[model samples]
Target: MSYYDVDAILTDAEKVPCQFELDVPYLGHLDNSAGLKPGTALSLPLWLAEMLALASAGEDARAPLTLNLPACLSEAVAAALKADPRAVALRDQSAHLYGVGVRMLDLFDERELGAVLRRTWAVRAADVGLHARKADEAVGGQGAEFLRGLEEWERALFRRGHEGVRRAREWMDRVKRS
Candidate 1:
């Protein structure tokens, strides 16, 4: 098994290699040896780390600041979301991760907006690694419930327009008014 930390949490070893199979040959005969090693577990993908690193910063490019993602696992941000858009669709419709995604949109500047968040249905490519790591922590426990909520969360944000994105629009509107 392999492990890494993201969003201030340690993810399971299995998720390190993007993903793996858990199907048991028989009902309970699952094999564990097939899991990846720490060596193969990926470091945070560069673009994503930079995204997180950038959002975590203050007004200065290099200032260390503290903030939190409203929800850490938007299906769009999910590493495997592209792999399973249907499942992601469900989660987006029912989870609060949507609200988080909305908030995250606020943190973006013209740079990330042009680079991420506009492709694959408001999904960002740079976020895949961190989201993949988060999926490992969520397969069981509150993960399922959190996702359940995420389905609704995303729905609300999309229906109403993401908070951050809306703020961006409002800011632009104000500038136009001025």
Candidate 2:
């Protein structure tokens, strides 16, 4: 994720499940308590969680916290995508679902999760391309529902596909006139 990418910034702000592995006396605000106790589960922004989860205390000490897959990339969502990628409303899950998934993949080694994410992206990208090509006609129809569900990555893909189609049509018109 690039430092200047708006989507990346937003993804970093997405909350993920985390559990404190060590007591933190002054960090209770994270869980609305007096202090964070060991084993205290909390929802923390990806940025903070990543740092805490990776910070080493000593040669033999565990990291301060453990990170869990965010709800957007949970098993239920994966199963839904596996069942029907098109039917899922990705934006509802998280506007930066793919971004969070990518970060989680970097920290974890779940090959099945990675494969499911790849398949979902491939299926949805093709659908986005199709919708982009027919954007004008699909604006007020059922396609609108699908279009509204696209996450940031798919939305970018749709814009590029739409622009390519429009440019191709313009070129074709000029050639015909010539």
Candidate 3:
């Protein structure tokens, strides 16, 4: 989530469902209308939505908007991940699925959702490591399908694991040569 991280920037660009809590005439263009109306729902990028949802008019006033979990983190997707993290194509859901989930988790308190996300990451990470260890053998079979479904973080993990295995083999080869 660093400021300069490309993946973090993309994560902030992921859109989430939001509802305006108050009408603001100047921001109408956001919703393709003359003026933004109260109760108006729109899909807004995480950055804009977070700012709007957290900005209050006064000490006792409510924020301008309410943020909802993005479609990628919907209940159905959670259920699918819970059932089988490997089966769900997270990349298809969002290239930054976990990032959006983390931001939403900060906005809302949903213990179950957090647990599901954590479990999903754990399961898929182990699979990615296994595939990395046997990268050559996995390139053409079922492993390719799973690898293709990985999101940004998982892809990095796979690359690191694969590199580690390659380096270890190279060291072993050098030892044998000596």
The 10-residue segment of model 1 with minimum total lDDT is: 11-20
Off by over 4 Å in 3: none
Tens digit of per-residue lDDT, candidate 3, span 19-93: 998878999998788998899999999999999899997899999899998899999999999999988999999
lDDT tens digits, residues 1-178, model 2? 5779899899999999999999899999876899999999999999999999999978998999999999999999999999999889999999999999999999999899999999999989998999999997758768778778999999999999999999999999999999
Order of all candidates by lDDT, from best down to worst? Answer: 2, 3, 1
Task: Give me the runs in candidate 1 sitting further than 4 Å from their true place.
Answer: 1-64, 68-71, 74-77, 89-94, 109-150, 153-178
Arranged by TM-score, best first: 2, 3, 1
Which lDDT tens digits does candidate 1 get at residues 1-178? 1234242132111111111122223322122344433222222322343343355234644412223332344334454444643344444332333333443455543333333333434542223323334554455875455435344424344334434555776899999999
Task: For candidate 3, give the lDDT of residue 42.
Answer: 95
What overall lDDT goes with each candidate model?
Answer: 0.37, 0.93, 0.92
Q: What is the TM-score of each candidate against the true structure?
A: 0.26, 0.96, 0.96
Give the Å error, residue 106, model 3: 1.1
Query: Candidate 2's error at 30, in angstroms?
Result: 1.5
lDDT (C-alpha) at residue 153 in model 1: 28
**Model 3: colliding residue pairs:** none
By TM-score, the better pick of 1 and 2 is 2
lDDT of 1: 0.37
Indicate the worst ten consecutive residues by lDDT in candidate 3: 136-145
Could you tell me the lDDT of residue 4 within candidate 2? 100
